[model samples]
Target chain A: MDEGSAALVAAGLGKRYRRGWALRGCAVAVPRGRIAALVGPNGAGKSTLMALATGLLRPTEGTVAVRGKPGFLAQGKPLYQGFTVEEVLHAGRALNPDWDDAYARRLVAEAEVPLGARIRTLSGGQRTRVALAVALGRRPEVLLLDEPLADLDPLARQEVMGALLAEVAEQGTTVLLSSHVIADLDGICDHLLLLSGGRVQLAGDVEELLAEHRLLIGPRELDVPAAAVVERRETGRQSTVLVRGLEPPDDAQAHEPTLEELALGYLRAGRTSGREVAA
Target chain B: MTWVAWRQQRLLTLVSLALVALVGAGMAALWADLSSVLPADPAVLDERYGDLLGYVPFVMLAMPVLLGMFAGAPVFAREFEQGTHVFGLTQSIGRTRWWATKLLVAGLPVTVAMALLGLLNAKALGPLSSILTSRLQTPMFESQGYVLGAYTAVAFALGATAGLVVRSTLGAMAITLAGYVGVLAAVANLGRPHYAGTEYSASGAVEPGAWRVEIGYLDAQGATTTFAGQKCGETPIAQCLLDQGVAGRFARYHPVSQFWEFQGAESGIVVLVVGVLVAVSAWAVRRVH
Candidate 1:
C-alpha cells in the first residue's frame, strides 16, 4: 500500500513487557477513510496495537506511526468519576487544542446525557457515550477505539456504533476499532486486520478477502490444496473445509464464507500453528 | 491542561487550605493573647500556655505529611487507579505538561498556605522561647519558621513521585508517610547540628535561648575530661568533684543567633530534595504505559 494513502501504518512493530513480547513482527496499514476491524482473541495484542498507534505505548522494536492527530477511546472508556458531564467536556476542551466544544456538546445532547450528572452516576452506556464525545471532541483525523463495545448490551452497542458511524461518515475520519467478537464488526467494517499470537494473521479489504475464500462441504475424502486450507472439520463421513484461493471439486457444495466464518477459521488455524511454533 | 488539573485537584486543595486556615486562625488568637501578656513572669506564661506547647508541636509536625498523603499521593495514583491517566495522557497535551500541571495545581496552594501558617506560628511562639526549651530542638524547630514550608514541599514532592512509581493511592500514601518521617528524623539527628559550628564554654554558661548539645567536664588544662570519681556517700557534690580533680564543666551549644542560619541551611537542603523528587516524577510519568 502507498504510505501516503495509509492513515495508520506499522512495520515490524513489537512491544515487550517484563514477562515476554505482547506483540511482535506485526505489520498493518489502515487505509485513509476506512473503518478497519481489528479482530483478535483475548491477549491477541489487539489493545497493544491500538495503544502503539495512538502513541500510548512505545514499541520495543520497529516503527508505528499515525498520520495526523489521533484520538483514542481506551478499554473501559475511562473518565474522571468525580467530574460532571459538563466538566468532562470542559476537560476535553482544555486538553486538546483542536477541540470542537459545540460538536462535543451536541454529541452529548444527542446521547441524552445530562450535563450536570457526575460520571459515576451515569449508566455504563451513558458513560461510554460521554467518553466517545470526549474522544471525538478533538476532531481527530484518526480514531482508535479498543474494545469499545465489550461492556455494552446489544441495544447500546448498536446505538453507540450507529452514533459513531454517523460521525465517521460525516467527518470521513479513519478508524481502527478493536473487538474480540467478529459479529459486532461483520457489516460495519470495510477492512479487516486480524491478529493472533502477537502477529498479523490476515489483513486486507474485507470484501475482496472474503470473496477469495470459500467454505466447502463434502465427503471426508475431499481433495484440496494443503496450502489453501485454512481449517477443516469432520463429522462422520462429512467434511467442512475453509480454503483460500482454491476451486471446489464437483462433488462438494461451495459458497463464499461469512466474515465470522473467515475470522474463526483463521483464529483456530493460528492457535494450532502457534502451539507448533512454540514447540 | 492547567484548568483540567485544577478541576481534578480542586477538592483536595480546598480541604488543605481550609485546614491551614483553621490552624492559622488559632495561631492568630494565641499570638494576640501572648502579645497582651508580654513582660510578665516566666511562670505565669508557662502556666497559661504550657499544655498547648505540649500538643502544638505534634499537630504542626503532622500537617505536612498529612497534606502530602492526602493532596499529593492521589494526584497521580487515583488517576492510575481509575484508569483516567490513559485518558489524560492520550490528549493533545504532552506527558511532561500533564505531570507538571497536576503537581503544581495540587501541591502549590497547600504549600503556600502552610508557609503562611509557619510564619504565623513563629509570631505566636516567639514570646515563649525563654520559658520553653531551646527552639532549635526537634518538634520546636520543625513546627515553626521556614522549615515548615520546606518540609511541606519535600513531603508533597515525595508523595507525588511515589504515586507515579507505585501507581496505587494507599501504597503512595504509606510511602509518603514513611519517607517524610525518615527524612525528618535523618535531617534532625544527623544534619541539623552540623549546619553551623558549635561554641564551647568552660563554665557551662550558655545564652538564654542557646541549644546545649553536650555537657562535659574540663580539667586544669582546659581540655574535656571524663568523670572518674566514685559516688559520694555523705560529702557535698562540689567537694567530691574537687577531690576527684575536676576543674570545671563545659558546654557545647548553638547560640540563639544561629536560628535563622539553621533554618536557611535546612530549608535549602529540603528544597534540593524536592527538586530531585520532581525530576523523578517527570521521568516516571513519561515512562508510564
Candidate 2:
C-alpha cells in the first residue's frame, strides 16, 4: 500500500496490559475515502486500535497515525449524560474549530432527536444518532467508530449506517469502523482488517480479498493442499474448506464464500494458529 | 473550551453558589444582631449569639471541605466514571487546556465566593471575637478570614488531583475529606502559629483573641518554660501558683493584631499548595491516556 494515500496506518503497533498484550505487531493501512471495517472477536483489540488511532490511547510499542484530524465515536457513544442534545452539539462546536453546526443540526433534525432532550433521557437508537451527529459535526478528515451499532436494534442500525453512508457520500471522509460482528459490516465496508487474539489475520480490499479465496466442499477423504487452506472443517462424510490463492484442486467442488464466511474463516484460523501481523 | 467546561460544570457551580448564598444570608442576620450587642460585655455578647457561636464555625469550616468534595473531586472523576473523558480528551482542544479550563471555570467561582464569605465571616465574628472562640485558632481561624477561600482552593486542588489519580468521585471525595482534614489539622495545630513571629509577653494579660502558642513562667535569665500543672496540685490556683515559686509570668502568643499577617501567611501557604496541585494536575493530564 502507498503510505502517502493511506488515511490510517499502523506499523508494528502493540498495546500491552497487565495480563497480556491486547494487540501486538499489527500493521494496517486503509486508503483515504475508503470505509474500512475492523473485525475481531471480543478482546481482539479492536477498541484498543481505535483508541490508539484517535490518540485517546498511547501505544505501548510501534506507531499508529491518522493523516488528518480524527473524529471518534467510542463504544456506548459516550456523551455527557447531563447535557441536552443541543448542549452536546454546542460542546462539539466549542471543541472543534472545524465543527459544522449546520450539518450537525440537519442530522439531528433528520433523526428527529429532540435538541432539548437530555442524553440520559434519549433511547438507545436516538443516542446513537446524536453521537453520530457529534462525530460528524467535527467534519473530520477521518472518522473512527468503535462498535457503533452494538446496542441498536436492526432498523436503528440500518438507519445509523444509512446516515453514516450519507455523510461519507457528501463529505467523502475516510471512515475506519470496528465491530466484532461481521454481518453488521456486510456491504457497507470496502476494506476489511480482521484481527484475532492480538494480531491482524487479514487486511486488504474486500473485493480482492474475497476474490483471492475460495471455499471447497467434498468427501472427507479428499486431499487438500494445506498451504492453500485458510480454514477447514470436516464432519464425517463431508469436508468444507476455505482456501486462499487463485487455483483450486480439481478433485473437489469449489465456490466463492460470502463475506461473513470469509471474515469468520480468517477469525477462526487466526485463533487456532495464533498468527502475528508482521511475521 | 471554556464554554464547554462551564456548561459541564453549570449544575455544580450553581449549587455551590446557592449554598454560599444560604450561609451568607444566615451569617448576615447573625451579624446584624451581634453587631448591636457586641463590646458591651462578653457575657452579653455570648447571651445574644451563644447558640450560633457554639456550632457556626464548625459549619463554616466544613464548607471548604464540602466545596472540595462536591465541586472539585467530581471534576475529573465524573468524566472518567461516566466514560465521557473519551469525548472531551479527543476533541481538537488539547487535553491540558481542557483540564486547566475546567479547573479554573468550575473552581474559581466557588473559591472566590468562599473568600468573600470569609471576609463577611471576619466582619460578623469580629466584635464577638474571643468571647467564645478565638479567631486565631484552629476551627475558627480556618473559618474566619481570607484564608477560608485559600483553604477551599487547597481542598479543591486536593480533590481534583486525587480524582485524576483515583478516577472515582466517591473515592476522591472520601480521600479529599480525610486528607483535607488531616492537612488542616497539621497546619493549624502544628504549623500555622509559627508562621508569624510569636511574641513573649512579660505579663500573661495578652489581648483577647490572641492565640496562645505557649504560656508559662519566664526565668530571670529570660528562658521560657512550661506551666507544669504538677506543681499546682489540686489546691486553689493562687495558692498552687504561690507554692510553685513561679517567677515572672510570660506568654508566647500570636496576637489578634496579627490576624492579617497570619491570614496572609496561611493563605500564601494554601496558595502554594494550589499552585503545586495545578502543576501536578497539568502533568497528570498528559499521562491519562
Candidate 3:
C-alpha cells in the first residue's frame, strides 16, 4: 500500500493449496520502469507467484505489495459476449477511476481490436489482444501479465510485445510478465525470476545471470572445477557443465552460457537431483 | 474499481430484469380474477384485487435472489476457474477496490430496478385485487407497502451475499433458495399465535364477585354487535368471560383474520436475517481470493 516504494516487493511469500505448496517462500522486488520475466517450467509456480503478487490469491504466509496501481492481463481473455469491444472498454472506463482514455484508444488502435466487434465473436488471439489493450489503457503503475503471448502467432506476439515495451518505455511502467518461451523474454525483459518446485531458484538481472553462469563443454575426463558445476550433462566424448557464479579461472577456457543454456542446465539439475532448488 | 473488476456481467443484469418483468406480468394475469366465480364476487372485487396484489412484493424477493446467484457468484469465481483472475488483481486498483467496484456495478442497479418495479407493479395491481375479492383488503397485507418493500430489499441483499460466499453460480443459487425457504418455514412454525397462559383463577384471586364480560357476533353483512354481561364464564359453549380481579377465562385469537399477522412478522424477521447475509457477502468479496 506504500505508494512511494518499489513497484513490487514480496517477502517470504508462500501459497499452499490442499495438495501441497504451489509456491513457497518466494520473494521478489521490481523497481519502477523495468520489465521482469517470471520464467519457469510447467507447474513451476510462475503463475501462482503472479497471482499472489497481483493480490488475486492470499499468500499462506508473507506479503506482496504493489507500490501503486497495477494492471493484470489474465491468462485467458474473458469479456462479455454481448458487448462490443468498444462497450467493454467503455465499461472499464466507467469502472476504473484511473482509466486513461487516450492510452486505451492508442492501444486499441495499435492492436487493431475492432471497436464494433462483439468480444465473443473475436478470435482467441484477438480477444487476448483486446484484454491486453484494456489493461494497457489503464496506464497502470505495474502490469502483471500471465502467458499473454501464449498461442499468439509470431506477428501477433510481436505486436503485443511491442505495445507492452512501448508502455514500459513511455510511461515508465514496471512490468512482470510470465512466459515459458525463453525467446519471448530474450530482449524484452531486463530481469528474470526462474522458479522450480514451488520456489525461486534464481532471480536477478538477465545480464548478471548470463555473466555468472557458464556452460563448459569438453572431454568427459577433462579436469573441471567441481565447485563451479551447478549442473552437468555427460556423454561418451562430450561433457557440458553449468558453472554457477563462475569467476572465470585465470587461464581457463570455460565459456559462459547463454541464458537459454543456463536455464536448461538449471532445469536439468532440477530433474536429476530432485532438489527443491528454491535456494 | 479496485482489484480487477469486469463489466462483462452486465449481461446477467439485463437478463435478470427482463425475466423478472415477464414473470411479474404472468403472475398478474394468473391471479387477476375477472369473474364472479373467482372469490367474494366482482361486486366486492376491491378485496379480490388486493389478493392479486400480493404477488408484487415477490418481485423484490425474486430479483435479489436472481442477482445473488447469477451476478455475485460469477463476478470473481469465473476468473479463477478460467485462470484469468490475475489480470484484474495486478491492476492499479487494489484487490479490495476491484471487489467493491464489482459489487457496486452489479448489485446497486439491480436493487434500484427492483424497487422501482415494485412501486409501479403495486400501483398497477391495486385495482385488480379489489375486483377479485373484498376479504383481501386487510390494511396489514397491502401490496407494495412498506412492509413488503422491506421484505424485498432484505431478500435481494441476502441473495447477493449468498453469491459472494458460495463463489459458484449454481452453488450460490441452490443454497440461497434453499435457505430462503427453510428460514421462512422455520419462523412461521415457531411464532404462530397460541395461548400462553391458563384461562381461569380461584375465588380469592377473583376478589369476591368482580366480573367483566362481553359478547360479540359478526353479522353476515360483516358488522359486529356487542352485548355486556354479568353472567361471566356462565356457559362453556358459545361464550367466554373472566373475573376482573383474577386471571379470567378468556379467548385468544390472531389480530388479522387469516395468517396475515404471521406473514408480516415472519417477513420482517426474514428480511433482517437476509440483510446480515448481504453484509457478510460484501465483506467476503472485499477479501476475495
Candidate 4:
C-alpha cells in the first residue's frame, strides 16, 4: 500500500527491554478503513507494536506513524478504579480535545452501565464497556486494541466487538485489534497481520492470504518442497501439511486453508525458525 | 487536564492540607496561651512548657516526610500500579502536561499550607525560644521558619520523583523516607553551621539566644590553646588555665539575629534539590513506558 492510503505504518520497527529484544525489524501497514486483526501468540510483540504506534513506548529503532489521532484500549482495559462512570467520561473529555461526550454517554447507556457507578464496583463486562466508551469518545482516526476481549465472557466479547464494529463502520475508522484467539477475529477482520517470535510472519488481506495457502493430507512418505511447507504434522500413516504458494501432489488431498489453519501454520513455522536461529 | 489531575489527587491533597491546618490550629492556641503568660520567670516558663517543647519539634520535624510518603509517593506510583498511567499518557494532553498538572495539583496546596503553618509556628514559638534550645538549632530551626515549607517541598518532590523512577508505591515511599531523613540530617549537621561567619567572644560569654558552636582557651599570645588540667593537681581548673599561659576563654557562636539568614540558606539548598527532583521527574515520566 502507498503511504497516503495506509492508516498505520511501521518500517523496521524494533523495541528492546532489559531481558532482550521484544520486537525487531518489523514492517507492515494496515490500509485505510480496514479492520486488521493482529494475531499472535503470547509475547509475540503485539502489545509492543501498539504501544510504539501510540507513542507510549519509544522505538529502539526505525519508525512507526499513525495517520491521525489514535485511540488505544490496552490489554487489561485499565480505567481509574476510583472514578465513577460519569467521571470517567469527564476524564475522557478533559484529556482529549476532540472528545464526544454525548456519544460516549450514549455508548455507556447502550451497554447499560450506570453513570454514577464507580469503576471498581462494575462487573468485568461493564468495565470493558466503559473502557471501550472512553476509547471511542475520542473519535480516533485509528483504533488500536490490545487483547481487548481477553477478560470478557463469550457474550460480552461479541457485544464489545459488535459495538466496536458499528462505530468503526459509521466513522470509517481504521482499527488494528490484537488477540491470540484467532476464532474471535475470524469473520470480523478484513486484514491480517500475524506476528510470532517478534517478527511479522504474515501480513496481507485475509481472503488473499487464505487463498494463497493450502492444507494437504497425504501419506507419511509423501515428498514436498521444503521451501513451500509452512508447517506439517504427522500421524501414524498420514501427514498434514500447510503450504503457501504451492500446488499439491497428485496423490494428496488438498483444499484452501481456514484462517485458523493459516495463522497457526505461520506461527508454528516462525517458532521453529526462531529455535533454529537460537541453535 | 488540570481538572482531571485535580480530581485524581483531590483526596490526598485535602488530607495533607487538613493535617497542616490541624497543626496550625494547635500552634495558634499555644501562641495565645504563651502570650497570656508573657514576662514570666525563665524557671516558671521552663517548668510549664519544657516537656511539651521536647515533643513538639520532633512531631513538626516528622510531618514533612509523612506527607511525602502518604501524599506524594502514590501520585505516580498508584497510576503505574493500576495501569492507569498508560491511559493518562495516551491522551491528547501530552505527557509533560499530565506530569506537571498532577505534580502541581497534588503538591502545591499542602506545601503552601505548611508554609503558612510555619509562619504561625514562628509567631507562637518565638517567645519560648530562650527556654528551649537555640532557634538556630535542630528541631527548632527546622520546625518554625520558611525552612519547614522548603523541607516539605523537597520531600514531596523526592517522593513524586521516586514514584516515577521506581513505579511502585511502597518502594517510592521507602525512598522518600530515607532520602528526606538523609537530606535533613546532612543539612542540619554540615550546612547550618556554615551559613554565616561565627563571631568570637574572648570572655567565653555569648548573648542569651546565640548558638555557641565551639568553646576553647586563649593563650597570652591570643592563640587557641588547651590547658593541662590534670597537671594542675589541686589547683582550680580556671586558675590552672591562666597559669598555663592561657589569657582568657574564647567562644565561637552564631548570634540569634542570624536565624533568618540560616533559614534562607537552608531553604535555598532545599529548594535547589526540589528543582532537581522536578527535572528528574520530567525526565523519568517520559521514559516510563
Error of 4 at B186 (Å): 1.3
DockQ metric for all predictions: 0.91, 0.82, 0.31, 0.85
Against the hidden reference, what TM-scores do the models get? 0.98, 0.95, 0.73, 0.97
Arrange candidates, best lDDT first: 1, 4, 2, 3
Residue-wise lDDT of candidate 1 within B166-280, one digit each (tens)? Answer: 9999999999999999999999998999999999877999977789999999878887777755576688888887877788999999987788899899999899989999989
CAPRI-wise, candidate 1 is high
Candidate 1 segments exceeding 4 Å error: A275-279, B229-236
Compared with the true structure, the alpha-carbon lDDT of candidate 1 equals 0.91
Per prediction, fnat is: 0.93, 0.85, 0.40, 0.75
- Comparing 1 with 3 on DockQ, the higher-scoring candidate is 1
Q: What is the C-alpha RMSD of each candidate to the true structure, in Å?
A: 1.5, 2.3, 8.7, 1.5
Question: Considering chain A alone, what is the TM-score of candidate 2?
Answer: 0.96
After TM-score superposition, what is the CA distance of residue A168 in candidate 1 from its true location, in Å? 0.6
lDDT of 3 by residue, B106-222 (tens): 666665665555455454543343333221233223333333444444544555565556656566667766765565455534543231222233221321111212223433343
DockQ of 2: 0.82
Residue pairs in candidate 2 whose N, alpha carbon or C atoms collide under 3 angstroms: none
Candidate 4 per-residue C-alpha lDDT over A1-279 given as tens digits, one digit per residue, 9 for 90 to 100: 676799999999989888778888999899999999999899888999999999999999999999977999998998999999999999999999899999999999999999999999998889998999999999899999999999889998999999989999999999999999999999899999998878888999999999888999999997899999988999999999998899889989999988898898888878976554223
Task: Report model 4's chain A TM-score.
Answer: 0.96
Q: Which stretches of candidate 3 lie over 4 Å from their true place?
A: A1-6, A245-254, A271-279, B1-155, B192-251, B257-264
lDDT minimum window of 10 residues, candidate 3 chain B: B206-215
lDDT of 4 at B15: 80
With candidate 1 superimposed using the best TM-score fit, by how many Å does residue B43's alpha carbon deviate from the native?
2.1
